[model samples]
Target: MTELVRMTGIEKRFPGVHALKQAQFDLKRGEVHALMGENGAGKSTLMKILSGIYRPDDGTVEIDGQPIELSGPKAAQAHGIGIIHQELSLMNDLTVGQNILIGKEPRRSFGRLDERELNRQAGELLGSMHMKLDPKTIVAELTIARQQMIEIAKALSNRSRILIMDEPTAALTDAEVSELFAIIGRLKSEGVGIIYISHKMDELKRIADRVTVMRDGEYVVTVEAADTPVSTIISMMVGRALKEETVTIPDLDTAETALSVRGLNRGRVIRDVSFEVRHGEILGFAGLMGAGRTEVARAIFGADPKDSGEVFVHGKPVSIGTPKDAVRAGIGYLSEDRKHFGLALGMDVRANIAMASLGQFTDMAGRLDEKAMQATANDYIERLAIRTPDDRQEVQLLSGGNQQKVVIAKWLLRDCDILIFDEPTRGIDVGAKGEIYRLLAALAADGKAIIVISSELPEILRVSHRIAVMCEGRLTGILPGGAGTTQEEIMHLATLRDAMTEEHA
Candidate 1:
């Protein structure tokens, strides 16, 4: 293999942070190199330099043995480098076609945009990628997975040779991941090198050819993917060997039911979904994207209107017509989109933590008791082990795991006994994910019924006492967690739709 992209002695620094310290990376032609690191470890910084999003303070970037300067993203694209960010960057107000061909739109003879040609080109590009989507469809109407696909399509449309993918599988389903891996294979065969950044060890083993570990803004080691153990890679990234945890199977036979949903129906997403979660039990919801797992959580949390359903909490039927009603009924929902739906990112951590339980901290005259609120925030910050400079620090400045902990703190302060964590560890690193799992285990053992909805099968098996599989909009099957359960079985149930009595299932 030939080295296609190389950065040596790379160093970058921000105002108060040394983002990269002599970080080095090399991508060989047709090879998928995985970058492993904890948050703030300079992986993104290095890639941003490579993608022309940031200029290196000092270093050398070489392309095919020739030194080059990346002035901006367009220059990087012109130089055969493209990056698909972890966050979706498409415009929701535009059509799919417009979003895809934003800066590269086709023009008519009269110097106007060619709408038909734009849609036709976008449709052709999607078809080439084996995506089934209408170019005329509104971007906002598409699901997150579809939007991620559009992001990928936009990157590929640039004919980039050196592609950098940042957590591309974070929102994709197993089937979609397979499709993406296939696309990577095809691209690699065409001599395209990929810099794959992800927290999923299994994905690294499956698709990557080499693994590079970074710790605290410096490159630690790079090794062959197959020769390196996942544990070893994790150790290199964290500078310590982290112990792998196993969930303790608690006996729930004598426990009382904490939450029960019967005949849950909402439009076409959720139908006839019935399940029960007992006190001190962690029920895992496992399913493919758009399988209605999140939808069921939303309906039960009263974030969305359910056409017909009966919800029981602590053996008492509850009418949860809104989030306020749900919160009053001891239910707390930690939405997956924490920044927008869960926390006010602009507010301080203490303020956000107190948002959910403000009624308890307010005086009779509608005055906020600052001392009481601050005490509560401090208590939870200590209890949940949230890493923050201070409670006064803004939530937006905290890491993903810390931000999530603040949301958990909000619910705990409000005395919510039934907790729903939807995609709780979506974007966090492995170490942070371990901490969260421990927190949930403690919460469940303390007699709080936990409903964990996760896209990762391993995550579903990790913390749940029993896994409930959702396909399309219904509960297809339930399996006990631990040794007996396998990914194959969960995947089978995930695709087991009522209409799929045939080959699809």
Candidate 2:
């Protein structure tokens, strides 16, 4: 194999933060290299430098054995580099073909837009990738999985030889992941060097050829993916051995019900859902994609309208028509899409933490008590172990794990007794996940009722006292969480459908 990319002694520094230090990496043509790291470990920063989004303060970069100074994204692209960010960057209103060939559209005479030529090229690219998508379809009309395919198509349309994919499978289903892996196989055969960044350990075995671990802005080691254990790679990334433990089911037999929902329905998305979380207990919701677990949470939180249901908090029926009403009734919801729904990314940590409960900090003069708000924010920041320069730092500047902690702090500051967390640790690293688990346990021990919705069976088992499984908008069954229950049983329940529905199908 020929050397495709090499970087040595890479260094980058942001205001009050050293993002990368003496980092080193190498990639060979026709291979998939996995970059493993915790949140804030400088993985994104290093890649940003490679993609020309950031200039390295110190480093040497060689592409195809030729040293080059990348001035911008165009420079990197000219050098056969392309990056698909973790966040989707497509224009929602644009058609698929228009987005794929946005800047490089084939033009007609007089430099006019050639719509037919553009669609033809994009359709060819999509066809090459075996993506069954209409080039004329609006991007917003597609599912996240399909839109992800468009991102890949757009990258490949640049004729990039070195491709960088960040968390590509985060929103994909099992079948969609299989399709993506097949595409990666095709790209490898064509001699494209792929830099794959993902937190899902299971994926490395399927797609990665070499695994490079980075910790605290420095390269730890690069090992052959086939020869290295998943545990070894995780240990290198987090600096410790992570032990898998099952949740210890607490005795909630006599505990009072903190949140209760009965006969919840939402037009085929949620059907006759019923559950309860007791004080001092954690109840986990388990389901596959589109299984209505999130819909149930949103309905219970009053973020979505429920056609027929009853919600009771502490044995008192509450009318929750909106999120504000739910909050007033002692319920807090942490949405899965935290960036869009949970936090104000542009605001400082102090403001976001205090946003939900500003009335508590208001003075007699109808002005916010800045001192009180700062004191409370700092206290929660310290308590939650959020790694930021200070509480005054913008939440957008913080890493994914820290941003999640900020959301948790906001809910904690609100002092909501019945809390619902949807995909609490979705994109966070292993080390941060441990911290979140401990925090949730502590909250439960402190008698705060918690409902955790997760797609990972292991996560549901690791955190819940009891697991509720949903299938096709219906509550299939509930099982005990711990060693007594296995992933197989949960899968059976998760795929279980009503007899009538199955018969109709």
Please provide, for model 1 over 437-495, each residue's C-alpha lDDT reduced to its tens digit, 9 standing for 90 to 100.
99999999999999999998888898889898888898888888866589999888888
Clashes of each: 0, 0
Best by lDDT: 2
lDDT tens string, model 2, 1-505?
9999999999998777888999999999999999999999998888889999999999999999988898999999999999988778999999999999989999999999999999999999988877788899999878666788899889989989999998888777677788889989989999999999998899989999999999989999999999999999999999989987557788889999998888899999899888788999998998788888888988888888999999999999999999999999989999878998999988999999999999999988899999999999999988999998888899987888999999999999999999999889887888898999999999999999999988777888899888888899998887888776899988888888861122100
Q: What is the C-alpha lDDT of each candidate?
A: 0.89, 0.90
TM-score versus the correct structure, for each prediction: 0.91, 0.93
- Candidate 2 versus truth, CA RMSD in Å, comes to 3.0
lDDT assessment of candidate 1:
0.89
lDDT of candidate 2?
A: 0.90
After aligning candidate 1 to the native by TM-score, how far in Å is the CA of 316 from where it should be?
2.2
lDDT measured at residue 178 in model 1 versus the true structure, 0 to 100 = 91
> What lDDT score goes with residue 242 in model 1?
90
